[model samples]
Target: MLSNQIRKYTTGIILIVIVVLISVLLFFRKTQLNPVTGKKQHINLTHQQEIELGLECAPDMAARFGGLYSNTDIKNKVKVIGQKLVAVRQVSKSPYQFDFHILADSQMVNTFSFPGGQIFITRGLLKLLKTDDEIAIILSHEIGHVMGRHTTEKLSGFDILEKFKDSTHVITNYSPNQINSYITDLLKITFDSEEESEADELALKYMVEAGYNPKAFPEILEKLSGKSEIPGAEDFLNRHPVPENRIENLKSTIIKYHKRK
Candidate 1:
């Protein structure tokens, strides 16, 4: 019995070492330079693959938000502004094709982006914006998320992949719906505080480059602060940095950019 116990312990150690070795191999093999951020990242998916995945998941995401908004004018407005930002910003020179949509949900006040460039804003959030610049700020921020490849980077992390591998029941038995749900859950995972700050900085730069007033960035954040009685404001706050903190960071960013100019 003692010999059997020792053997089991030895086998467990061997399995742990094997897992570590495989993770290390995957890490080195997948490391690639992110074009927009100029930082090396361990991403397992190509730009095309990211775009394809976004496309596959877009329908399901839209359905969750009550399908795409039926208003042509609102849809066109979002598309126009989104395209304008992408056209003028240097970071938008990536391989991902950017598309923007408005969700029909009038009660969920939030915005988000998919891996490759699909951005969506809810009608509920749209009604709160006071200016076109504020709209630009929102879209530019989502653009920053795409440009930074936050979703893919988060998904490709060693820990997440390991968890996914362990949880997956069969290698080839997963359905498209299951894959979509998995990716959707992954996307729902909030960006860390540092990432949120970085995306804000990116958005500020993009807005400035695109000739939008940098002040609008913080102004919108202030509007979205805790004082607001918006229906989904609490949910938004939970997923994002505190408004005061974001505003302070944006102020510093604006000062630095102005000094450079």
Candidate 2:
């Protein structure tokens, strides 16, 4: 009986040591610099891995939003603007392959991007946009998320390998409820307000490079702030810096980047 007890304690000690070792390895492995932001970031996934993950998850994500929008004109417009954003030398140099999608859900006023480069904006958010420049602003902001590799940076802090053992199961096996909950949690994840601010700055730069007015970025944020009392808009608002704060920062960015000498 004593021998069995001793063996059980030894096994427990071995498991604890293994867990600690894995944690240490993950910490050390994650200290690479972000290509776009030029900041040291902890991201476990490679650009290729992030792209594959986004591609695998894209179909399921669209399904959750009641599938893709049926309007070819709107769809084509988003694709064109997204491509223009990528055409900017700064964005074009990145490793991600950006793709834009318009979600059919008209009640959710939000825009989001998966790691790598799959960006989606709901029709509800599209309805709020008053010009092509507004669309450019939104898509470029998402492009910033992709370029910043924010999603994988979030995943790096967790036991990503354990959570996505097969990786393929991230899209294939999870139930709709499970996927929704997982994505909701991910969307809630943030990298301080600095990251959002940086994305805004990037959006401004990209919009200007694409020949859209940087002022439109701030205009859309103001519009969203006015409509914040709407139910589903919380996803966009809560996850971002307050619109007033963003507008203030954006003014500084516009002066620094967009002002004529």
Candidate 3:
């Protein structure tokens, strides 16, 4: 009887393992090609899904900090600046649909973007910038984040999100903390390490290609370093902080691509 029970238990375990393996295989098979990033990605959200998600979350983001900037003219001016930066020939094929907004906050000193081209800048950071060059520098970096599909890649890791959606369970919006994580962690990570280096290089390229000074990015970086909110935000200004070699790498990339104009 004991032997019989052991056999039954082993068979059940094998069945469970097979089911899990099948589930995992199905999950991986859902991976699709990312048009923006130009790679096959494991993201569970479609392009339409990403657009809908960005549109849905945008309202709460604006409302969280007293809504968008009140002045329509200033809003239009900001949009114009962003468009100027994007108009560069190098970015013509970029998938970003830029929507520039100046946030109401007066303390945060950062400009950020979402996976599907949702762009935002705190008034604090905007007030700090002195010229169109600085704004272009910041926007170019944010555009890199959008093009890299950073948040979408991060969300792919949260298997719970994928599983829930896959299971057809109800979906609701994230709370403030969740939003912060996506903005600061997921999106930030894209701008944080190697990805950060890529964005910085892209920013410099975008600047020069736009006929603005190529040095604008590092100059803006120097300015951002002075009034950063987080202690390590200083490190952010320097794309490659740890090895201390990123600056040189950046310089080399700039020189190599200097004739890109």
Candidate 4:
């Protein structure tokens, strides 16, 4: 009887702890500055905290696919192109150090970035592109993720995802198998489709703002869709994939900018 009472108390204490911890997180103090979109955010992290976090993971990130490229020429080329995409652009205004790299891997098609301005690509994705413009699009898309603070937005997502007692928390463990936590990873990726589309729009604006032809946006989308010349694409078609609709948005961006210009 005494042991049963003790077990009940322990369970109750654990539940109380979890509740308090989550409550503290929810009301976690946030700052007023918004760097990426200039809109206020409920983030409790400072820019310095963000920069430190990026640097901390950077080495492992570099080592992801054989410790970055030994090919200076290829690596330099990727950096040059990446710099051009952010060249004289708003993202260039970032005070933290900005660096770009292409991994030595041949089995990945992913392009991703870290908050402190670390951009990465796989040689696999590089070989897939038929033009520098396509490369620009990919890097800029990743950059869009950075400049738009999509990852940061996703961080908030973790907090939100955790609020539901049933949802629980699961993080990806990128160890021997890399995607050991694939389920949570995919769950986190289950963002509102509108965020994805908004990021694409920003990508187009930033690309053209960086002087690459905006057409590269849809062109790469077409290629990714795997049916550029088939009158419709398999990528991003939605339940009813429509490239023309997206193209129209890209086309009107300049006009919208000019109205503000």
Query: Per-candidate RMSD vs. true structure?
Result: 5.2, 5.4, 4.9, 8.5
Model 1: per-residue Cα lDDT over 1-261, one tens digit each:
999999999999999999999999867777779767788886776776667667767777888889999989878887887888898747556788889999898887788888888888888889888777889989999888888888778776534234333232313334566666655676466877777887888888888888777776776777677665567765566656564677888888988988987
Off by over 4 Å in 3: 1-24, 35-40, 87-96, 159-191, 226-243
For the record, the alpha-carbon RMSD of candidate 4 to the native fold, in angstroms, is 8.5
- Cα lDDT for residue 85, candidate 2: 90
TM-score of candidate 3 to 2 decimals = 0.72
What TM-score, over all chains together, does every model reach?
0.81, 0.81, 0.72, 0.65
Tell me the tens digit of each residue's lDDT in model 3 across 5-45.
99999999999999999998886776666564466666776
Q: lDDT per residue, candidate 4, 1-261, as tens digits?
A: 999999999999999999999886665444235565666555544444445545656667667567787888777777887888777567778665567888777665556566557777777668777777778777877677666665655564443223322222333323433322322342234324445566676676777777776565655655655464422222123321334566566557745665663
The lDDT-based order of candidates, best leading, equals 2, 1, 3, 4
Clashes of 4: 1
Worst lDDT 10-window in candidate 2: 165-174
Model 3 worst lDDT run, 10 consecutive residues = 235-244
**Which model scores highest in lDDT?**
2
**Candidate closest to the true structure, highest TM-score:** 1
Q: Which stretches of candidate 2 lie over 4 Å from their true place?
A: 1-26, 158-184, 227-231
